[model samples]
Target: MKNTSALFIIDDVIANQLLELDDEYIGYQVLHEESFYKHLLDVQEFPVIDEYSNKESHKALLVIRSWQEVREILKEVQKEKNINAWKRLFPCQLYADGAYGEDTIIQNLSCAERLLIRAVQEQKYVMFYC
Candidate 1:
C-alpha cells in the first residue's frame, strides 16, 4: 500500500516541497486519463486530497499541457472503467484518504479526477503527480 495519489499544485517546485510533497507534476495525469476498460487496471489514482499527502520531498514540474490537451486527456479518462470503479468504490471520496484495499493502494487517488475537472473548466494547466 504505497502512498500513491495525485493533485494540483502552484507550478512551483519550491512551494510543492514546502508543503512536504514529492513528485509535483502537470499533465493529463495518466491515472486520471480514462480508458475503455481495456489494458488498464490498478489500485491507484483518486480521492481529492490536496492537503494530505505523505511524501515529504516533493514538488517539480514534470509535465506541461495546454488547456486543449488537458481536456483531451481527461476525455480519455472518462471512458476508462477503472477510473469510474475507483469513484464507485469510494462514494465518500475522502474515505479514500489513508485508505488501502489492494496491493497497490494510493491514498486520495480520486483527487486527480477532481483536479482534472477543475483544470478543464478553468481552462488552465495544473500541476499533478502520484
Candidate 2:
C-alpha cells in the first residue's frame, strides 16, 4: 500500500474536538505523500510524538506542531536551489497515478504554507497526521 499523510492548521477548539473523536476524519486537511515531510520538508521531529504510545496506528497518527516551526521550515525549504530534487521526489505521476489520491508535494506544501499563514494570523497550531 502507498503511504500518505495530511497536514492541518486549526485552532485549539478543533484540535480538541478531533482528539476527542474516534479518529473518524479531519477537516481542512492538506494531503501529501509520506516522503513529503521526510525528504522535501526535512522535518526531524513531530509535535506530540511523545504523547502517544502507538507510533504506528491503523487509524491515524496525530501530531501537533507549532505554526512558527512549520513556517520556518517552509522558508528554509524554499531556499533549496535544486528544482530537480523536488521533481524527483514528487514526480507528477505520483499524484496522477492515484496511488493515494494526493496532490503533488509542492502543491500540498503550498496549501500547508497558506494554512500556516492563516494559523499565524489567527494564533493557531499546525497538526500533522499520517
> How does each model score on TM-score?
0.37, 0.38
For residues 31-122, could you state the per-residue lDDT of candidate 2 as single tens digits? 23342222232222222222221344444445665667655554545513533333332223333434332234444445444555665565
Q: What lDDT does candidate 1 reach at residue 105?
A: 31
* Candidate 1 lDDT over residue span 10-47, tens digit each: 33343233344353443234334333112222234443
Q: lDDT at 73 for candidate 2? A: 51
RMSD of each: 13.6, 13.0
Candidates in order have lDDT scores of 0.42, 0.42
Weakest lDDT window of 10 consecutive positions for candidate 1: 34-43
Which candidate has the highest TM-score of all? 2
